[model samples]
Each structure stands twice: as C-alpha cells, then as structure tokens.
Target: MTSPDDSLQLTATELRMATFRLARRLRCARAADSMSDAQLAVLADLRMNGRRTISTLAERERVTAPSMTNTINGLEEQGYVTRAVDEDDRRRVQVEITDAGAELVVETIRRRDVLLADMLADLDFTEDELTTLREASVLMRRVTDR
Candidate 1:
C-alpha cells in the first residue's frame, strides 16, 4: 500500500547507500596500504595540475590554509613534494611533486584499480550494467568537479 513518492524516496536512498559503501570500501583499502586518503588526493591533484600555490590547493581541497600547510609539510618530509619560491615574486611559493611523488601516485592508482577490478570480478554484472556504471562514473566526476 505504498505510494509512488515512497517508492521514489526508497530508490534514492538505495542509490545513496550503494555510493557510500563503494566509496568506503575503496578508502579502507587505500588506507590499509599506509597512504592517507588526503595525501593521495593531494598527490593526484598535483599530478594533474602541475605546480600550484598553497592557497589554491587549500581552496581546491576544501581545507583550511593551516591544514594544507601541515599536509604539505608531511609530504615534504617524505621527499614526495617540494616548495620553491616564485622567481619573479619571492614572496610567493609554489608546491610541486617530486619524481618520487609522481611514482608513488602512479603506483597507488594501479593498486586501487587492481583492488576495484578484483571486487568487480565477483559481481554478476551484464554488459549493459557495466556500460551504465561507466557512464555514471563520468557523471559523478562532473558533479565532483563543482
């Protein structure tokens, strides 16, 4: 005796649960490998965008300036990142990933993909389902970009 509105709400909740579970699993797997999710995210950003200022990174990551500073300090200590003064403006500083940082990011990405592939292998998904999932991933990326 449920109404159409109830059915739609249930469907929306189910979708949200599925997304949460998948993201949680992926994050847990990544964490178990000794890399913090925040660090990996920052590394990925640097790889995609090259050098960036600390303020820009803080904004992009939706974190405060001090938090970004601490994160960058940790990465610097691990030799994964370095900061350099702007040649034209000594007051400005830019952060860049080192060779080791790039390598670590690539390795981490491969590991995550392998983990996801293993998980997906057991799912009884058809071709259409797979295609839909791929398209949904693209849309999800667009949503996150905002």
Candidate 2:
C-alpha cells in the first residue's frame, strides 16, 4: 500500500496535469476571430484589475516594454482599448479597456462556458463524481487565492 506521503505526491501530480489539460482545452474553445491570446490576456487583466500603466502591464505579462507597447497599439487601433496620459503624471500613460473590449471578454467567456458545459454533459458524470469535482474546484480556488 502507498504511504500517506506517496499518496499526496501522486495526488499533486494528477491535479497539476488535469488542470493544465483543462486550461488548454478551454483555450481551444475561444472564438476563431477573437483577439490573440496575449492581447486577450491584457484585456482581461485590465478589466479585472482596472486601469494600469503600460509598464505595469508589461511587467505583469513578463514581456519587454516594446513588445507590450506594440500589443497595446494594435488593441488601440481596433478600438478595444484606449490610452490616456495619467492625470497626476502627464509623462505616464495608462491603458484601459473600452466597452468593446469588455464585451469581447464577456463573449469569450460565454463561448468557453458553453463549450465546457457541452463537454461535461457528454461525460454523463454521476452525482458523486460531480460533487467531488465541485469540492475540488473549491479547494483549487483556495489554493489560488494565496
């Protein structure tokens, strides 16, 4: 029989792999004409965290400042985002999502949810299995919150 420590290690590996695969599958559900992944990430970040400086966004994304600048420029051209000089510091520019950007984020989520729901329906999971997943999801959220 496996020791408690061995069981914990196995459980951790399984959870990691499952979550990674789930994330990839969800990405596949994105709309074909939607913004690229990186652009969408930036938009989502802005929407969730409110407006922030270009430099701050770049740091969070772990990309070069110039690369982030280019991404922001494309988003701006498409009217998905707008940049404005910081009122407190004219030299600093802050980026914010537009109504179109927020709408895109919401729509993308809706599409992914529909896809996931259909996939889950096909699984025909038992009530016990569903309850276990729900509990695991709550645990996952607690882990992420830290």
Candidate 3:
C-alpha cells in the first residue's frame, strides 16, 4: 500500500534505529575504563588521522579550543597523549597519541569485535543475510566518508 519512496523512508528509519542500538551495545564493551567518550574519540581521531593541532582536533570534534585543550590536558595527565612543538612551525603544537593510547584503541577494538562476533554467532541469520549485513556496513562507511 506504500509508494516506493515511502518504503525507502521506512527502511532508512529502521536502519538508523538499528545502527544506534548496535553502537550503544558496543559502547559497553569498550576497554578504556578511564577514558571519557570525548577523550577516546579524540584519541581515535589522532590514531586514524595522524597528529593534528589542538584547533584542528577541536574543529573536528565540534568543541571550542579551550574545551579541547582541557580534554587534551586530562589525556596528557593520564599518559594517553603528548604534545610537541611542530618541527616546521614553532607557533603550533601537534597532539600525538602515546603508545598507551594506541594500545587502548587496539584493546577497545578487540573487545568490540569479540562482543559483536559472539552476538552474531548467537543469532540465527543465514549466510546470505550475514553477507548482506557486511555489504551494508561497507555502504554505510562510504556514505559517511562523503
């Protein structure tokens, strides 16, 4: 009884809700107990995008420079990150992840993967459905990358 457009809208809404639920569930499996979500996000950003200035990180995270600075200060105190003067520009400081930060990211990812894999194993999805889910994940990444 629905138009094709209406069906697409319904599918999109359902997908969004499902993805949110899955993400929240995975958040509980995080390994970095001492890190706040914002701190962890900044660490993950550095790990993925390489070293960046505090201003750049602030813009990426949509927080004020001072707010980002405070977050960075806490992270530094925890020994998860360090700041160094940019070799090419003395005026700018680049925030870099420490070895401990990288290890935290790896452990967090491993925990999430294990949790998700166990949940998937408990599900009764067919191989074809699992393949479709994998394809959907790829498509979702491409959508967000734009």
Candidate 4:
C-alpha cells in the first residue's frame, strides 16, 4: 500500500537517526575515559598543529579570549603545555604542548579507538555493512569539511 517514495524516505530517516545515536553514544563513552572534552580537544589541536597564540586557539575553539586564557593556564599548571614569548615579537606569547601533552593526546585517541572497536565487534555486521559504514563516514567527513 505504501509508495516507493515513502519507503525511501523512511529508510533515510532511520539511517539519519541511527548515525546520530551512534555519534552521541561514542562521544559519551569517550568523555568517560578521562580528561574533559575541551581539554582533550585543546591537547589534540596543539599536538596536531604545533604552537599557536591564545587568540588563535580561542578562535579555533570558538571560545572567548578569557576562557582560552584560563584553559591555557590550567594546561600550563598541569605541565601539559608551555607559553613562551615569541623571539621576534616579545609581546606575543606562543603556546606549545609539551611531550607529556602529546602523550596524553595519544592515550586519549587509543582509548576512543578501543571503545569504538568494542562497539563494532558487538555489532556483528557483515563486511558489506562495514564498507557501507566506511563510505558513510567519508561522506560525513566531507560534509563537515565544508
């Protein structure tokens, strides 16, 4: 009794809901691993992008300058990051992640991977299903990249 258009729309809606639920669950599981999400995000950014100014980091993180300052201060107190005056411009402070910070980023990524692997294992999905998921991930990344 249902038209093909209705069937297609229902399938699309289900896929969208499933993807949203999976992402939400994964984020929650990752958060439970250790560091707060903001701390982890900052560390990961520094590890990947090297040194940056407080203002730059604030812009990238979509936080206010004062909030970014506080975050950086906390990180420095924890010995995860260091701030030094730029040699060419003494007034400018550049923030860099220390070796310890990089280690934390690596550990965080490993924990997330473990969590995801466990979830994938429990799914009992076929190889085709995984390939489809992989393709969907690529599409999702492309959409975000814009």
lDDT by candidate, in order shown:
0.86, 0.90, 0.92, 0.84
Model 3 TM-score (2 dp): 0.91
Across residues 21-85, which tens digit of lDDT does each residue of candidate 2 receive? 98888887654375788998899899999899989999999899999999999999999899989
Regions more than 4 Å wrong, model 4: 1-24, 27-34
What's the lDDT for residue 99 in model 3? 91
Q: Which candidate is the best by TM-score?
A: 3
lDDT (10s digit) by residue, model 1, range 37-112: 8888898899989999889999999999999999999889988899999888899999999998898888777777
- Per-model C-alpha RMSD: 2.7, 2.1, 1.5, 3.8
> What are the TM-scores, per candidate, against the unseen true structure?
0.86, 0.84, 0.91, 0.80
Question: What's the lDDT of the predicted structure labeled candidate 3?
Answer: 0.92
Residue 25's lDDT within candidate 3 is 92
Which clashing pairs does model 2 show?
Answer: none
**For residues 22-123, could you state the per-residue lDDT of candidate 4 as single tens digits?**
767666654225556777778889999999999999999999989999999888888889999998999999999999889888876777688888999898
Q: For residues 1-146, write the lDDT of model 3, one tens digit per residue.
A: 99999999999999899999998898888777767889989989999989999999999999999999999999999898999999999999999999998889888989999999999999978999999999999999997777
Q: Which segments of model 2 are wrong by more than 4 Å? A: 1-5, 32-34
Clash count, one per candidate: 0, 0, 0, 0
| Ten-residue region with minimum lDDT total, candidate 1 | 26-35
Question: What is the Cα-based TM-score of model 4?
Answer: 0.80
